[model samples]
Target: MTTKNLLVELFVEELPPKALKKLGDAFASVLCEQLRTQGLASASSVATAYASPRRLAAHVTHVRSKAQDQAVLQKLMPVSVGLTADGQATPALLKKLASLGADVSDPAAAVAALKRQGQGKAEALFYDSLVKGVTLDVGLQKALDEAIRQLPIPKVMTYQLDTDCGMPHFLPGWTSVHFVRPAHGLVALHGDTVVPVKALGLTAGNATQGHRFEAAKTPVVIAHADAYAQTLRDDGAVIASFAERRGEIARQLAARAAEVGGGCRPIEDDALLDEVTALVERPNVLVCQFEPEFLEVPQECLILTMKANQKYFPLLDAQGKLTNKFLVVSNISPADPSAVIGGNERVVRPRLADAKFFFDQDRKRPLESRVLGLAKVVYHNKLGSQGERVERVSAIARAIAQQLGGEALARQADQAALLAKADLLTDMVGEFPELQGIMGGYYARHDGLGNDIAEAIEDHYKPRFAGDELPRNPVGVCVALADKLETLVGMFGIGNLPSGDKDPFALRRHALGVVRMLIEKDLPLDLGQILATSAEVFGERVFTSGPMPSETPEGSIGIGSIGVKIDPETIPKVRDFIYDRLSGSLREQGYSAQEVDAVLALRPQRLSEVARRLAAVRTFAALPEAPALAAANKRVGNILKKADAEVQPVVRPELLKEPAETALHAALEQVASVADAAWADGDYTANLKALAALKGPVDAFFDQVMVNADDPALKANRLGLLATLHQAMNRVADLSRLAA
Candidate 1:
């Protein structure tokens, strides 16, 4: 058996750490799928991808030299031009034909068209366009070229443009190769001799280098990808393995921390570690010490300042207490790391001093004292000021607390919500934006409001990203939900909703945060009511914007701020935007688009409740007969959809006649009884099954009987029966929206 290997590499300027893994995995998976779809065979390996700040590479072994060609057919749908009655292509059709590359002006082409052949069969039309008939064992080189050409990267430029100029890629226009990074060169060598990699206008060689300072040059020639990686490592740098880098760093960190009478715990920053590892060919962990006085500043401020700003890992003692020392993973082994440690400590000292100043200033006047200052800080001119939002949040939180029945915590939640945004205007939060909620919690604790209030202040921003933690305490949950709701209402009030990847306000994050708290924390607060109250706060702003210039009250104050008069129509529009956010949020949890429609049809007041009903229906949908039941639902749905097409019919039992109609009616009655009992008990699965049982009878009734009969009395009876089915079904879901 013959064997071939494929290798691709890219070298470029340093990439943003965030785009590394995603770009690496995308190139490999997209290329692999494209290859298989194009009929390449005997490919049984994953393309091993390696990514760094400046380079990305992929290696595929056991690659076939040729692709297994298969026939593909295309269809020529009827053109808009008229055809002759005898099924001949007409003069008008021929006149417009040249637009599609048909040489209709030629006598032979016109004659063939006038004769009319090769109609109806999709394959025949496509086959005629092919320059050659389907042949076996087509060259794999062409397939690889085609696949790579189609890989979509958000940004690309071409160094060398091919003859067929498509959209310019995210690389140099003259560069006729596709690479996620710069392709310094390709190396397709076999032993000492170089193998040709000229298929896509690329040539391979046998030269590589190691770390610049340690081993800048190597006199080795690599024949294969595996050997190439090993040779580089043998020279001085460990190449090709992220696991090895992580292990080396962890080992050094552990031994160093042990010397300090403690051990380094891994921070929850895999992304940071990955980028740091890529910065060096060899990773050496160095533990650096700082003055313990910095510990007086909030741990979050110190840790975030170190990790987010400096890319350093903070250390912890055996008891999980924060230590004055931190671990800095370096690319090169420094001769005097004490200098490195001292440099980092000096940089961090000023940051902590800023934190200390904010803490001391904030405590001198409690967070509540600063709440009035937020009134001058406008959140959105149309949505009211920051102080107004705080009041709205307080109301929303208290209502949520009342719903959860934490009277005392609910009151504390109201106070916490009012004070939450007060930290936004603080000096510390201005420097470290991520520490907004954390600092609020710290200041609250310093004021002796205790842990619950302090936690509520911090927990309000519990989930800053997907899969992040949600508020665990009830007060925290209320405050968090309130905070997100206020932001959503305010931003949407100003018509600043996210549009096509442009979200200046981070509304998507706020919406998702609301979803996480509702679903993960299982907060039972209704979103509809909360939005209504918040909307009222906005509505007042709208009304105060002044009604259409009226004759009365001519001397009254004119209402307009930041050039927008908050009109009545804007409130419902903003509310609909919130609903859209809710539907999208629920869609991420594996709910079908139709399921989202069904649950949303119920006019959900609370986002958490909306998620619950959707979850219940989703679980119920997985039962053995779910699809069949959904099919049955479609039948009942059709009858009801048509019946209620004009108006929703109220079931009037008096107009009953046909046995089939009566039987379906009685079955619906029994189902309704079960549905009510289950719905009241919150057993939606049982309710859905009970509703599903009506599908068989519904199908039979629809087949055996007609609803729009000649007799008016009998027609009303049948319509009433369909209406009864609709009412029973709506209890579980708006099955009328179910797909056929």
Candidate 2:
């Protein structure tokens, strides 16, 4: 079979800008896969995707014109049913042969045609046939049809097709079809030949329209499969390849920014760049400027309006400050671009004016005044209004502040938490919800609040996402921690936990935020104590449902979990949930499972000490005596666990009958005092390292003594000595976890 490059394109009205790249990639990959499945292409075939605002096309190389013929063997029937006593063809054999379209004119010849294979219980008759190969036209039609059916369109559009679309498969009357967009033309070419495929009520042809306005020709003609991209570019006044067009736009943006001088460059945002690339085919980047006074508004507001509303790239100086000038990616290229630049400027003025008006008007009223409006806004049906949530947060903030910074920080935290959600009622935030916290900071400053209060209001939602920065100051830290804890405890108290990928309440994000602040900020706050105090703000009546469901992942986290619902008893589940999240984080940071498990199993109160504890464990595990000590630790634990009664962890020197027990008891006094001193001073590495000195005595005691003595006093004394040894060795981490 001969092979050639293949090209297929769907010409339609403007496609969605954000979904264009995904649609193109999906269409090409699925089409190529179908060809390979049908044996029309090989594994080595290459597929290239091209997507623009008005078209989606794919070019596949090394596609065969026809699949190779195949040899097939099929089981007919048992040998007994096909052959009789005289070896003549049975009536069932003749009927089965006729159904298969096999030659059945002579019974004897047909019987001889099938081969017999004898087996123990049953022998079967097999028929062999040569199946003809499939032509490329038939294969591509199937592939094209399958490709259209499987496109990951964000939304489907239904439209009526008329005779003008030249759909050969349809009559002269109108027909309705559904697709991502309305199709006006379809092109499918195999080498130099046109593939007569039908899709979306349109027939495939070699001609397609390009660049609705500035194309050099009405209908661009592709002569061959390999010439599709080049011809479309030369004759259609469009850049068919999406990547090529995006690169050109970026190059033009950089060049134009340099031309503006003062070390200007366009803001870096890949999502914005991709959307602009999809909106134009042949990009002509032109510089445009807005009023210099509009920069009075926050640069976030200005930059957001330009990128989100106008689809323009705002320029910034070397200092990363927004300039009065921005760039536009126009689809048309004219001899003179002054008209385009002026038109863009005129269009953006009203947008900036609206923002400035909102800003100026918002400053007239204080953020504290807006606090009352939050009473009417619903946060959750089960959980009260946003106003109620604010009160809870304020209380939690005060409690946390008193613990960390006393009355001074508590006052600032209370003020910030009180007005943190106030911006949600602002005019600017109403227009763009993304500016919720940002608007509050500006308004707080306008109301004569101190920088501490203003900064805290702005950063109360800090570390909102993974790798996001934490709050800047101590006051900000207090409010931020309070805000996240309130959301977590409130949601979990309501039995609204995240199930699978469906985190409608964003509980996972909120939980992760708490962990980040606790660990990264190195705040010496106890997670359990804070969570308990936070839950107390809601009172005992806050829980309105039952236990967490067994199906939720929360059930598996160390605490007792039943079916998920709101209940007062479920409050303890938060500790397990937070620690579960921490364990995963530690593993991601390159700590071994044994290392993480050993340190976290003890549930240390201070998160700041966790890193130090892990470092200490790593250093101790590298010691030459660590293996024997770890194994001995495991044995001691088992012995203590199997004690007939609770063997008190007290060693009686008077009851020490054996030399090994005497030596071990002496070693604990010498080594354990030092380990305890180091642990008390937060020197965890020294604490664990001090245990390595006792390995020799530990091995001697285990080798020479039997823990289960016939006399209860001897057994108790041996057990107590081992208990003292266990306590000393595991002060930093559970050494038994290190055992294989």
Candidate 3:
């Protein structure tokens, strides 16, 4: 037994900073399997991997010297065939056949071997053979080779001479060995000096480089793979951990902001810095300032320009007002840092000027005037332009508003939807794609539109992503819903439905946005009605087979699903992509997946109703006796199944003879009234609590009475009472369907 260490690094041209870590993990996983399949086992902890933009590496400690030895031989010799077709064999027969691999050619001879007499007989001879074998290093090399050969690398290239390497790899030319980018080189080290990675044309060396900036002139020597990371960090310019980088950057940004009149707080921007670290080997923070007059620009514009364009962090005052200064994290500490600050300020100047131009230009036309421009913008090639889209949205929004009985808001909603996308064609939005809706609102307000309408225009695209905020007002929710539905229906109608991971039209986002409006904002909507109205408005543009089937159809049915015909009897696929995203959004607010799934199972047509029902179920489920009550519900279901077979039955309290039956009937009546009131009030939790109360009496009634009696009348009577219980139970939820 010998302890060993193995290292394999794929050094390549600067990789996609974001995809490097994931690819490294994938490479290690793929290699680990290959090694294990070759019977290379580790005596200590399992293999581990590390990755950076330029390299992917792995190490396995305490590996066995070689796979344990074992024998390999066929065990095929039918006991019946040991003797001739007869049951016995002659003494000469055994001796004559001994030349073959058989122990005995007689049935009794084999049987006699199993039962040794008091006197011992000659011991049976054994066959010799060897199992699959490999020397440790050879096995390791073969494993590495197989892994490299089978590794999945897309868009691979080779910079060297072409060779017919015995592997079907991603690279078209040069040696079979390849990397995602050109392999800058590789180092497969075993303890010390150059462990030749000749297979990949890389020679392991003690030489490695550190920071591309500060340490650009320094070459650090590393004796082993374990020390390679440390050497790079000690001599290199930065740390590898993403958390550490973010923490350090935030600390420096805060400290710089504090040095000024105000403290700088980081605005949540979807984890941009985590990805930024992969691009820079080191980070140097500097405080930069622009003309205070620039602060007049919308806070959003300022933040976006600083972050999206220049990768600068905006500073905020103690009162949370945007300040005139910004923080820039640079990879290099310049001789005159003020030069870097000047360069960034210069780059952002045009963007701010553009914003100012749009802002000033928008003041003259007002949103009302721009509505005409959206028509020429073309919302869709088949359906129409943004102008046409605006009209359709107006119609759909008005219809939804009328449905919601918001006559005034409905009129405003229609107006908002029509004007929402108009901003897309405006100078401000044209310059900054992110300000589409906000600019529309800004223009509307400048045009003297009512605050409600302006807000609706701005809010139509609320909750742009999962966990993002929803529209602040109900009118905004209605208009936003109408706006998103119009796009989804129009695109889906035109055969431009999302295929695979490709959603060119952003329809899925629109759908999820719609779902969120319903669930989070308590907007009551019927998805089918919304989709139908949108489709009708768009006419020929709608292109789906139907509303994506809520459930797979009966046997051998052919309906397209994710680019393939769904199988008959396929369990209703819960469009998990949508639900998972929804669940994640809800989970962040402290909702559990099971609770969300339970509500989703009811196929809530309105997101608001789903939230209400989820709240109720979660509350009811917390009761200690909830499981027992659910069991009672199941029993009521069983009785109703039999009760349905007979003529229509009704609960007639006058005919009740048993006290248990009478009590159960009375309980149902009381619960029904309360449940109906709760449902009307949109208080599903109260309804669930009311229903749970029936469980105790339901159990007592079933115990004391027979559902099927000798007398047909009594059986039917009992069954009918249970049916009433079932009807009551169904109001809250089909508890039987929920997982315990």
Candidate 4:
């Protein structure tokens, strides 16, 4: 029952930087989980993962040297099959016992000891046995192999090892192994003893190499399981923990940026920080600078090139503008660091020069001229060329703008939509697709287009993700909405709807963008009308022509009309998709399921009014009479649903015989007038609250009246009164959904 911490390490060539963190977490979690499943570790055992450029390791505390033995009961088979009519063991029963490693010499005794348990319609025989515990060496070997197999490797390389000395089936020097990278060493220790585990053709040992060029000792010897981290740090001259290395780099970046003065700091990017941490064991942040003239180019282009091509953090001023100086994380530190700084600066100069060249070359020709080039770029096989998509988007944008404003806004939006995709042909955007809309704005400005058009071109792709900013100007809003609507209607029309987690066309994002624009911007436009207009713009292109007889050859031009006419029935499907996204989004914002269901049940055409109605529903639900009213509303709905014919909402005063029925009819008449006025004025909360005065009359009518009376005329009159009450209460939302 004695326990000690266990340590395991795999030393290999440098791993993929972006996948290193996930790889480390997966390895440690799976190893500890396997041990716990086998009963070698308790629920309280902790696992710590360590990952560096050349290593992946884990240390687990409270792992037992051996698991405890326990009794296991396993159902074998039905009693009818395991026993003969005379109550003797059959050949099949004996064979099953043999497979379980049970003693078959005394089959009759074993069968006698078996217990019967009911399973469905039949009784089954069960076998009980004491399972032996697994030793540390064997358990650790299995866990180690499983951990390596599940490392989340992005890509695998096949290589041959120098020797396969301990491998069971392969000859020495000829065996091949596949891994993220070539494995050179592995270390596994239980306390001070080496656990005999093998992986990637290497036998586990108690020693590993560190920091190829900076380790104090060539082979850092881990004395015991608990000493693994400290020994590696002291002798290896490396920070093995990924988080610790990242923190050190961040501290150094801050210190160096402060030394430069003028409120300068390293640009904030978590992904860049993680990649830098994965690239070095010993981080030395050094400040480097390039010629200040490069600043004339757009800072976005320069910043993106530095971070993507060189993995360097570009410095920025207090005003959030890029500065000339940048920070580079070196893998080693020297007494005089000028050489490393100069080398990094020298390497970055060419990358900056290339970005400047692309920007300059892109500006020579106006963005408007590139519109013709997009015809060669395929947007999708079924959707035809980007040129065709641009035409559809431009038409939709103008229609939306005309509805929102007048001729001026419509003209600006149309021009912006026409030029938005033109940037795809520019040298700058060709090099970096992330800079497409951004570069369009710059190039349009350079071409002497007004600020409205330039800004619209840039902001049309705004709110690309959740919580991202919306377009800043009205023209931009029109184009953004049009762009998203075009995608949604076109895809859904062609039967390309998103299936669980598999939206290749990003239809869900497009739908959410439309919802945000309509609801958050309060655009006062009808979603169904917009979808219909966009579908018309697509015309015959929305239909699928089955599969293409053959794909257009690469670099081929003028591949004529591939799409047929669209199915008109898809318009409602597209509208419903947008509403589904809205429902999910509102629920995620902290509304209860019942509240959301009630508000969304109406499927209001004006999305901007939804929030008002939901607020009104919430306010009404808080009233003292809400439960009784909600229950009465539910009862009324069920009563109307069971009627043989459609019940009219007209209640004749002469037919109201019961005092309770007459009282309820009078109360509804008085309340409905007030609620109707509030609803007409868009005071939804006041309207729903005004209906709360009918709770007493509603409850009393339901308590004293028999809705299904013997006389058909009386029954119809009662149904009419209930229908009138149902309509008044459910104007804002379906209150019955709020009932428990």
- Winning model by TM-score: 4
lDDT of 2 by residue, 401-471 (tens): 99889998898899999999999988899887888788888889889998888888888988878788988
lDDT (0 to 1) per candidate: 0.65, 0.87, 0.66, 0.89
In candidate 4, list every pair of residues with a backbone clash: none
Tens-digit lDDT track of model 4 for 1-740? 88998999999999999999999999999999999988888899999999999999999999998999999999998988989989899999999998998888987888888888997549999999889999888898888888888778898899887664567677766788889999989999888989888888888999998888889998999999899878888999889899899999999999999999899999999999999999999899999999999999999999999999999999999999999999999998899999999999999999899999998898889988989877767777678678888999999999999999989899989999999999999888889999989999999999999888888899998788999888888999999999999888878866899999999988888889888988899989988888889988977544222323234455654335455455788888988898899999999998888888898887888798889888988998999989888988898999999999998898889999999999999999999999999989999999989888999898889889999999999999999999999999998999999998
Residue by residue across 478-591, what tens digits does model 3's lDDT show? 788778877666554445767789988776787688777776656567765666676667543332232222233655442332222212211122133345556666777787
TM-score on alpha carbons, each prediction: 0.72, 0.88, 0.74, 0.92
TM-score for model 2?
A: 0.88
Candidate 3 overall lDDT versus native: 0.66
lDDT of 1 by residue, 97-153 (tens): 555455765644543543223556321222133223221124333434544565455
- Model 2, residue 299: C-alpha shift (Å): 1.6
Candidate 1 error regions (>4 Å): 1-46, 52-191, 195-205, 216-226, 236-243, 250-264, 334-354, 376-378, 381-385, 398-411, 500-504, 516-525, 540-600, 604-706, 709-711, 735-740
How well does model 1 score by local distance difference test?
Answer: 0.65
Show where candidate 4 strays beyond 4 Å. Answer: 73-128, 164-168, 541-560, 644-648, 706-717
Candidate 3, position 244, lDDT: 53
In Å, residue 313's CA in model 3 sits off its true spot by 3.4
Clashes counted in candidate 4 amount to: 0
Summed backbone clashes in each candidate are 22, 10, 14, 0
